[model samples]
Target: MKLGVVGKGGAGKTTVAALLAEAYVAEGRRVVAIDTDSNPNLGISMGLSLEETEAVPVLPRSMLVGVQGDVTADELIGEYGTDTPVGATLLSAIKVTEAGAGCTCGGHATVRSLLSDALADRADVTLIDMEAGLEHLSRSGGTLAHADVLLVVMEPSRKGVLTAARTLPLAEELGIPFTVGLGNKAKRPDDRRFFEDLCAEHGVPLAGVVPHDDDVVAAGRTGRCLTASSAPAVRAEIDAVIAHLDALTG
Candidate 1:
């Protein structure tokens, strides 16, 4: 499965991507997790220490500039991918490290090429933590174009829902086969219902809900990997969400 997880900032898309990658790893699947965010942090979320995450090499902008899309799966991954503690290979797409780093158009092109290449078939599961918001979908040769499924995560807020609402049609425009809306961080009685109704009203297919959990917050504070044992309830919801995705895509 080639899955892309996207959302507005703070909508828990990174958390969702990390959880899904780890969950698939636990199921004995070969997984590759790609972080396409300019502010990349999926490495740390996947259990790499801060130093390790920083040290993981990102796809160089120079190599990607005017890329001919000729690289093979093994070549690209073997050269740049790093192994995470959770048994998944992690690849960082782009990071603005210097003052005059040019625009990330090349980085987006590289990710788009990677997703469409044989890399899609090389892993049992390939998950991309796409750049936040609708810009990615709007760009030509965007990263998620070839994704088998796109998870549009939304928080319990109007802006979050609006982002998801705007993203669903763009996913279709990109010819992504499946796109679903996920509600995250629902704390109040109406929070879950709020997203549910808004998604329904906006024609966004509902996936599943992950409620607000202190364990997630605590794990972030301690700089630790959130495991199924650490946050069983959230993991349970994520597992169900994965199952829902499976049923839809399969």
Candidate 2:
């Protein structure tokens, strides 16, 4: 299963990705979680210590360029991927190491290549926590083209809904097989309704909603990983999302 999680910053896409990876790992599936964000922190969400998260190797642009057809995606992952405490192999596509470095077009290409060449025969569940916003959709359609599903995370706010409104069409243009809207951090009755209305208006399928949980906040404050085991309500929500995914692609 190849899944790509995308949303604007603060919408909890990384959280969703990390939880899914951890969930699948606990099920004994070989999982690969790639932090394709410029600000790579999926490692922290996946239960890595601060030192370990910082130590994750940023896949260099030069390596992506050089290893093109010569290396299989699994080989590259085996050579460069870091093992997370949650039992998933983690990789980062790019990082901003210096100021005035310009846009990460090269890094987007790197992710594009990796996803394009991802191994299909393996039983591994590949999850990508993509860069924030819709630029990734516009800039690198090929990056997520091969994905079996795209989870567009949205919150209660207008920007979140707007991002989802813009993103779904792009995923369609890219030919991703299944695209669904995931409502995250929903607090009030209206908050959930807002996402429901937006998805309805946009003609996109609504996957599920994750309520605003204090445990999620506490976990971040304590530098702890926020897994389903840590938050019961969150576990229920994510399990529904998983079931929705299975129904879509089973």
Candidate 3:
């Protein structure tokens, strides 16, 4: 399964992807987690230290755009993709600043190529951590239509819910076969309902919810992997979401 997780900037989409990738790996699946965000931290979230990931070199930009000496898909993923400590292969899109802060011209194009190549091969599972908003993939002149599941996560606030509403259609417009909504950072039962109602109103099914857990926040402060430090409740919620996803699989 290739699952693309997207939402607002501060939403926990990356957290969801990291946890899912680890869970799949624990089940002995060969998982590949792609960080499509400009500020790539999936490596750290998967347990690699900031310094260790820094040395992994940005994926060569030339590989995707067909520059004079552009590298082939096999060459690109082979040379730059790293086998993470968490048992998942990782590929980070070039950081915005690395390609010039204000302009990310070919950056998305690069990830588009990576995503295409990754999906072309059969794998146990692949999780994509996308940048905020639905524009990123479209802007790349590509469609996430090939991904098995496209999850739009929200936070139960007006802004969060509204963003999910806008994102759902964009994914569908791109022909994303099985797009769904997910509520994150919930503090109470009503929080989950808010997103569920929004999903119903917008015609998108709700996958499930992840409740607010201080342990999730604490993991960030202590610089530890969330799969190891997150509260059991948080993991349980995510497991529920994954179950919902699996049920859709043939």
Candidate 4:
């Protein structure tokens, strides 16, 4: 099951993705949580120590360029796939550099290559924490072209809900069979209801909700991993979302 998790910048996509990765790992599945976000902090969320995250090898410059002018996806993954903690293999689309260079074509090229290939097939549950918004889709239609599902996370606002609504058709057009709305950062019970109602009114499929919790915020602030969080409520919400997805995909 290849899953794509996308949302606004602060919508907790990485947190949810990490939870899903760990959930599937606990289920004894081979889970590869691809951190396609350019910022590349999904490792921290997935329980990688600061040192390990710093040591993650970026997709080499050589991998992006070749004699044919663009290396094949197989070549990139074969050489650059980095395994992380918790039975998950991770690949960052962004190359880590001290130079802080501009124009990230190499990163996008790596993403495009991976998407063009069925690279997610390497694991039992391939969960991708995508960068914020839907530009990644437009930029790599072939990657998501036959995806199993997409979980569009939202913050329970009009724009968030409507943007998720607008994304459904594009996912469908990309040949993604299933897409659902995931309400994240809901501060109250009614927040979930509001998200569902908005989805229903706007034609988006509201699959499930993850409530607001200080544990999540604290982990984000301190750079600690969600796998280390003591909060079960946040985890329970993720499990519920995954359960719903399992039923849908099965």
Top model number, lDDT: 1
> Which tens-of-lDDT digit does each residue in 15-45 have in candidate 4?
8888788878877888766676667888888
TM-score of each: 0.94, 0.91, 0.87, 0.85
**Clashes (N, CA, C under 3 Å) per candidate:** 0, 0, 0, 0
lDDT value, residue 107 of candidate 4:
62
Alpha carbon lDDT of each predicted model: 0.85, 0.81, 0.74, 0.75
- Name the regions of candidate 1 deviating beyond 4 angstroms: 62-69
Indicate the residue-level lDDT of 219 in model 3. Answer: 71
Name the 10 consecutive residues with the lowest summed lDDT in model 2.
62-71
Q: Name the 10 consecutive residues with the lowest summed lDDT in model 1.
A: 61-70
lDDT of 4 at 25: 86
Q: What TM-score does candidate 2 reach?
A: 0.91
lDDT of 4 at 184: 87
Clash-forming residue pairs, model 2: none
Judged by lDDT against the true structure, how good is candidate 2? 0.81
Model 3: per-residue lDDT, tens digit, 20-50? 8887777788787778777787788888888
How far does residue 70 in candidate 3 sit from its true spot (Å)?
A: 6.2
The alpha-carbon deviation from the true structure for residue 231 of candidate 4, after best TM-score superposition, in angstroms, is 1.9
Q: Per-residue lDDT for 6-71 in model 2, tens only?
A: 988888888889888888887788888888888888899999988888888877663452244556
Query: Tens digits of per-residue lDDT for model 1 on 72-99?
Result: 6787788899999878999998888888
